[model samples]
Target: MDYSGSFAQEWQNEEKEDNNQKGRNRMIHFRMKNNIGSVTVADRILEMAALALAVFLVVLAVALYHYLPERIPVHFNSVGEADGWGGKGMIFMLSALGVVAMAICSAAAYNYKMVNLPFSLNPACLSQQVTIIGRMMRVLSVLCGLLFIALMLMTTVPQWGMQSVFFSFFLIVMTSMTVVLIVYTVWIYKKGRQYR
Candidate 1:
C-alpha cells in the first residue's frame, strides 16, 4: 500500500501526454512547411490573373490618355451622375492606385505569417488557417483590380450614355463581392476554432 509508487506512475502518465502533444504540434508545423514548397495550380492562376489585371489597367490608362477629355468625371453622386471633374491625368493616378492595391494584397498573401488575425489560432490549425487567409487575400486583390477597371470605364466612356446604369450595376457588384469576402473570412475563422 505504498503511495510513492502510485505518485510516480501518475507523473509518467502526465509526461507521456505532454510528449504526445509535442509530437502533434511538430507534425502540424511540418505540414505547414511542406505546403510552402508545393504551390497549387489554382494559386498560380490567381496570382497570374491579378498581375495581368494590374498591367492591363496601366496599359488601358496610357492608351486612353490622349483621347480622354481634359475634365473627366472623378466623382459620382448617389444618382450615379458625375458630380466632380478633374484633369485627365487623374486616370493614370487611378490606374496606379489599382496597381498599388494589387501589390499590397499580393504582398500580404505572400507574407501571411505577418498578418494579424482577429482571433488566436490553435497551433494545430495554424497552417490551414494561414493558407486560407492568404488565398483570400489574393482573391480580394483580383476583385479590387476589377472594381477599378469598372470605375475607369464608367468615368472614361461617358459618351456611351450608359454611365448611370453601369455605375449602379458596379455598386451592386462591389457590395456583393464584399459580402462574399466577409462571409468567407468568417467561415475560415470559425473552422479554425473547430480544430481547438
Candidate 2:
C-alpha cells in the first residue's frame, strides 16, 4: 500500500479548500470589523455634538435672559406694562432647566462613548461596564430629550406672540438633533451586541 501519490494529492486538495475558506472568513471578519469601527466613530461624534449643543443652549439661555428685558417687545399686554421681568423671568427659568437637562444627557452620552471606545478599538475586551453604561446613556438621553421638548413646548406655545420665531427655530434644531442622537444610540447598542 504505497499510497504516497494519492495521499499527497488529497492533502493538496484539503489545503486548497482550507485556504479558500480562510479567505472568505477573513473577508467577512474584515467587513464586520469595519462596520464596528464606523458605528463607534459615529457614536462618538454624535456624543460630542450633543455636548456642544448642550453647552451652547445653556449659554444662549443665560445671554437671552440677561438681554431680553432691554431688547424684547414689552408692550404685549397691559399687565406686563409696568415690568416685563415676570414673563421674561419665567421663560428664562424654563429654558435654563431645558438646557440643564440637555447638558446632563450630553454628559451621559459622552460617558457611554468613552466606555465603549475600548470595545471598538479591541472588541475582545468588551465587558459589563461598557454594556451597562451604554444602556444607561441610551435611556437617559431619551428621557432628557423628552423633558427638553416638553419644556420648550410649555414655554414657547403660549408665548407665541413674543418668541414665536425664535422658539420655532430653536425647537426645529433641537428636535432634529435629538432624533439623530436617538438613532445613533440605537446603532451603537446594536453594534455593542456584536461585540458581546
Candidate 3:
C-alpha cells in the first residue's frame, strides 16, 4: 500500500468538502441578497419607524423609573382595573419587550422566504411575497412597540389622562395589527395563486 495514494485521496476529499461549503455559502448569500433587495421604500420606512418607537419606549421607561412608585401596577383586569402589582423595574421589562418585538420582526423580514404560508407558492413569487411580508412584520413591530409604550405610560402615571390615552392607543394598535395581518396575508395568498 503506497502512502502517497492514500494522501492524494484524502486531499481530494478535503477539496470536495471545501467546494461544497463554498456552494452552501453562496446559496446563503444569494438568499440574503434576494431578501434585502426586495425590500421596498415603504418597508424601510416602517422598519425605521418600528426601531425608533422601540428605542423611544426604552428611553421613556428609563426616564420614568426613578420617579415611579416602588410598587407599580403590572397587570390589569378585563374591566380596566389594575389587578397585579410589581416593582418599578417591571417598566423596564415592558420596554425591553418592545425591543424584543422589533428584533423578531427584523429577523422575520430578513428571512421572509422561510415564513410559513397556508398555501404553496412558485419560486418566482417569493420576491413579491418577501416585500409584502416584510412590510407586515415591520408594521406589526411598530404597533407592538406602541402598545407596550402605552401600557408603560398607564402604569407609571395612571392619573395623568393616561388611562384614556392608553386605551385609545391600545385600540388603534390592535385594530391596525389586525387589518395589516389580514390584508397582507390575503394579498400574498392571492398573488401566490396567480404565480402558481
Candidate 4:
C-alpha cells in the first residue's frame, strides 16, 4: 500500500509522540530509591534499635513494678533534684511513653509515601528531602525510645539519683537531638545545591 510518502511521515510522528507520553508517565509513577517511600537497610537497623529500646523499657517497668513503693519520683529539677512525686502507677508511663513514641515514629516512617506530614510536596526536592527526613526520623525515634528507657530505669534505681540520672539524661538527649538536626539540615542544603 505504498506507505513511504506523507502517510509514513504521519505514522512516524504519532509513534514518537506516543513514546514520549509513555516516558513521562513512567517518570510520574517512579519513586526515588532509598527514600522514605521504601524502607532501606538503614531504616531496618534503626527500627531494630527502637524495638530493643522498647523491650528494655518494658523489662524495667516489670522490675520496678514489684518494688517501686507507693510513691514514685516523677519530676527532676534543673539541678537534678527530685522535687515532684507521684503514685507508683505513674512510673509505668515512662515505659508506656517509649512504646508510644516508637509506634508514632514507625507509623510515620512507613507511611511517608502516603502522607508527608512534616514535609511538603515539592516534586523537585521530594526525593532528597524524603531520604534525609527518613533517616532523621529513624534516629530521633531511637533516641526517644532510649531516653524513655533510661528514665524508666532511673525510676527503678533510687541510687542512680536525679543528679546523675536525670541530668545526664538531659545532656545526652539534648546533645543527640541537636547534633542530629544540625547534620540533617546541612545534608539537605548540600544535596539541594548539588541537584540544583
Clashes of each: 0, 0, 0, 0
State the local distance difference test value for candidate 2.
Answer: 0.52
lDDT of each residue in 1-196, candidate 3, tens digit only: 6799999999999999999999999999887566543767887888888888977998899999988888999987765568899999999899888789778877887777656768765467767777777777878888888888878887976756467667677777778889988898999888778876
lDDT per residue (tens digit) for residues 54-165 in model 4: 8887887887788777887788777666678888887678788888887787676655563344334455776766766677778888988877866765565565444476
Candidate 3: 10-residue stretch with minimal lDDT? 31-40
Candidate 1 segments exceeding 4 Å error:
1-38, 113-116
Model-by-model lDDT, in order?
0.82, 0.52, 0.80, 0.73
Best by TM-score: 3
Top lDDT hit: 1
Cα lDDT tens digits, model 1, 117-191, are 677765677667767777777887888888888888878768778887679767976886788678767877887
TM-score, predicted candidate 4 vs. hidden true structure: 0.73
Model 4, residue 143: C-alpha shift (Å): 0.4
Residue 172 CA displacement from its true place in model 3, Å: 1.7
Per-residue error for 58 in candidate 3, Å, reads: 1.2
Q: Which ranges in model 2 have alpha carbons more than 4 Å from their true place?
A: 1-59, 66-86, 113-164, 193-196
- Candidate 1 C-alpha error for residue 69, in Å: 0.8
lDDT of 2 at 132: 42
Model 2, TM vs. native: 0.37
Q: What are the runs in model 3 whose C-alpha is more than 4 Å off?
A: 1-37
